[model samples]
Target: MLTSAILAETGHAAPTVPGLASVIPFVILLLCIAILPLIHKTSHWWEHNKNKLIVALSLGLVTIAYYQMRGYGIAHGDHATDPGIRTVLTVLDHAILGEFIPFISLLFSLYVISGGIRVKGDIPAHPITNTVFLAIGGLLASFIGTTGASMLLIRPVLRTNSERKHVVHTVIFFIFIVSNIGGCLLPIGDPPLFLGYLKGVPFLWTFKLWKEWAFCLVVLLVIYYAWDTIAYKKESKQDVTLDETRVTPIGIDGKINFLWLAGVVFVTGTMDPTKPFLGTGWTPFPFLRELLQTAFVGLSLVSTGKGVRAANHFSYTAILEVACLFIGIFICMQAPIEILNLKGASLGVDTPYKFFWATGALSSFLDNAPTYVVFFETANALTHEPGPGILQLLSGHFIREDLLIAISLGAVFMGANTYIGNGPNFMVKSIAEHAKIKMPSFFGYMGYSVCILIPVFCAVMFLFL
Candidate 1:
C-alpha cells in the first residue's frame, strides 16, 4: 500500500492525491508562527525555547515519516536501497547541508558584518530626511541583501525617529520598500532571484526589472513622504521638539566590514556549481559556498570592535528565531514542491498574469527560494523545452519572456505582503519591537500592505506583466 501510494503520487502509473499529507507540518508551523506570538500574552508556552524545540522536532518527525512511508531516499538512490535509514539520511543531508547551513551561514554573515558597521549619529527624522533614508536603504538592498540592508539601516532609522510618537508607519513602509520591493533588481538582493541565477538565468537578467523597481519605489516613497509629513505636523502640534544634543554627525564605525562585504559579493558572484574551484583537477564541493561564507562571518566577528556591536544592540536572537522556524519550513515544503513539479501544468497557470499571481501568492507564504524553483519548473514544463536551462528557453523562444518576467517579479516583489513573506520582514519587525517600537501584529501588518502595496502591484501588472 505504501509503495502504491508513493508510486502513484510520483506520477508513475496514475496520479493519486499527490500526498498532501506531507504539507500538514508546513501548515502547522506557519499557523504557530502566525498565531503564537499574538497569543504570547496569555500563554507563555510560545515564549519558551522548549516549546519551539518541540514544535520543530514534531514537524521534522512528520516529514521523516512521510518520506519513509513513500520510500524516498537520496537523490541518486536506487530502488534496492533501504528506505527507512536512507530516507532519514537524505532528509538530514538535504535539510542541514543543502538548505539550512547555507541559508543560515549567509544570514549570519550579513547580520554579523552589518551589525559591526554602526551608523554613528542621528539625522532629524523630518519627512524629507526619512524619505531619503528609505531611498538609500532601497538602493543598498540591491547590493547587500534585503536582510543585510535591513539590519544595517533599521537601527539608524529608529534612532532618527526616536523623538516621534507615530513611527510604526515608518517601519511598515521600510518593510515594504527596503525588505521586499527593493530586492527586485538583482539576484543578490533576494533569495528567489539568486535561485533563478543558480538555475541558469543570467546574472544580469533581473536588471530588466529596473522599471518595476522605479515604479514601486516612486509610488511608495511619495506616499511615505506625504504620510510622514502629516504625522510629523501632528506631533509638532502636540509640542514635540527635536533633541538637538541627541543628534550627531552621520558617519560609520567598523568600516573594515565593507571589505568583508565586498568579499561576500565576490564569493556569491563567482561560486558556480558547474565550474571547477581552481583547475580541471579539482571540482568544487556543494558546501564550498557555505564554507566560504562561514569564514567571512568569522572575519567579521574578529575584525570589529566590541563597541560597534554593542551600539547596534547586536544579539543572535533574531537569527536564532529564523533558524528555528525555517527548518520546519524547508522540510515540509518539499511535498508542495514535488506536487507542483508533477502536476503544475494542469493548474490553469498558463498565462503570464496567472504565473505572476500564483507564484507571488505562494511566495508570500512559503520560503520564496523554493517557491521560485517550483514555479520556474512549472513555467519550464509549459514550454516542454528540451533543456532545463532558463537562458536556453529564452534564447530559443521555447518559453514566453513575459511569463518568465511575471514569475520573477511575483517571487521577488510580493514578499512584502506579510511578515512571513520574506525572512527579513520578520527580523526587521523583531528588531523594532526589541527597541520598544511596537510593531503591528501579523494581520495588522498585512492590513498596511493590502492598502499600500497591492495597488502598486496592480499598476505593475498593467504596465509590465
Candidate 2:
C-alpha cells in the first residue's frame, strides 16, 4: 500500500499490517472476556459487586497503562521520518470519536439522574407511566443523543421498577429501544449517522432509517408489552400487596442543573466535522467555540458537585472510564484503520447490501464513525469518476439514494447488535448493573441481541436498507 510504501522510502521502519499488529490487543481483550466469565462463575465474587469490579478494573487499567505508556513513544517513533502514523492519528483523533457524542451525552444524562432525591414508597404503579417514559426516552435520545437520554432516564426507570422481583427484561428492553435503536431518525440521533452527515450525507437523509426504526421500535414495544403483561399478571396472581402508605416520591436532592446538562448535549452534538456555521464572511470566534464546549462539560461536572462532599467525583467516574477504555481502543486500533483504508478497494464489496452489512458489522464493534468514513471513502474512491458532482464525488459515480440509504441505515441501526456496538450500550448496562439490575454478561448480552435484533435487522436489510 502507499502508506507502507511511503514508510519504506522515508528511512523509517515500515509499519506492519494491521492484521499482525492487532494480535496483542485482541489477545488481551480475549483474555479479559475469558476471565470475566470465570469471575462470574465463582460465587465468591458476584457480578453485581460494582466496588469489587471497580477495584479489579482499576488494577487491570494500571497494568495496561504501564504497557501502553511504554509503547506510546514508539507508537509515534517514526512520525518524524514517516507521516503514516501521524496522518492516521490526525484523522482519527478525538474529533472522530466525537461522532459518538450522543452516546456520551446519554451517560452524562444518567449521572445527573443518579443524584436525585429518594421518593417515599407506596405510590400507585401505572404501566402507562413506563410506556410513556420509554416513549419520551426514545424521543429524547434522538434529540439530545441516546446516551444523554438513557443516562437521564435509566435511574428513574430503575427506581420505578426497583421493588419488582422481575425487572431484568425491562432494563434489557431499555438498552435495546432507548439506548441504541431509537437514534435512527436524524443525524443528531446517533454518532455514526452524524458522521455520515458531516461528511456530506445530507442531514435529512437519515429519514431513510425511519422504516428500520419503526420495525425495531414496534418489535421492542411488543416484547416489552408481553413481558410486562406476564409480570403484571404474576403480581396479580400472587396477590402481592404493596405498602402504599410507605411509598414516597423522591425529589431532586442535588442541584437540578438542567441547563448545564443541556449545554453539554449541545456542544457534544453540534461540534462536528461539518463545523456548522463556521464561516459566513464574518469574524469567527475560534477561542469562544473552544471555551463553550469546555465550559459546557466542565460546568456540567462542577454543577454536579454542589451538593456533594467531593465535587465532580461521580460525574468524572463514568466519563473517565469511557475516556480510558475508548482511548486504548482508539490508539491500538489505528493500524487496523489505516490498513482498512489502504486496502478498502480490494475487499470486493460493492453492493449496497454488502456495504450496509460490511460497514455495519464492523461498526457493531469498531468505532462506527470511522467505520462509516472508511467505507464511504472506499466507495467514493472506487472510480476516478469524471465529472464534478457532489453526489458523484461521494459515491465514486454510482451515488444512488438507495445506496446511501443502505449505508446510513446499516451503520446506524446495526450498532445495537452488541454491548460495544455503541458507547451507551455498555455504559447503560454498566450503570444498570451499578444500580443492581442484574444485567447479562458480555456474551450473554450478545445472545439476547443476536436472537432478537439480528432477525429484525436482516428483515430490514431485505425490505429496506
Which prediction has the highest lDDT against the true structure?
1
**Could you give the C-alpha RMSD of every candidate to the true structure, in order shown?**
4.4, 6.4
Candidate 1 lDDT, 200-238, residue by residue in tens: 676788898899899999999999999999998778533
| TM-score versus the correct structure, for each prediction | 0.90, 0.74
lDDT per model vs. reference: 0.78, 0.59
**Local accuracy of candidate 2 as per-residue lDDT tens digits, 1-465:** 113333332335644333454435533543453355457465344333453345434543443343333322122235322344534434234323332243444454445443322222234345555666677777777776776667666766776665566777777778878877788787767777766765666566677667778877877777677767677656542333552333566554344456655665555445543354543444423334334655655655565545441311233455545544554455444445666765777899787888888888887777566677788777766545344432542222445555566666677777777666677776677667666777777677778878877888788878775
Error of 1 at 265 (Å): 1.8
- State, as a TM-score between 0 and 1, how close model 2 is to the true structure: 0.74
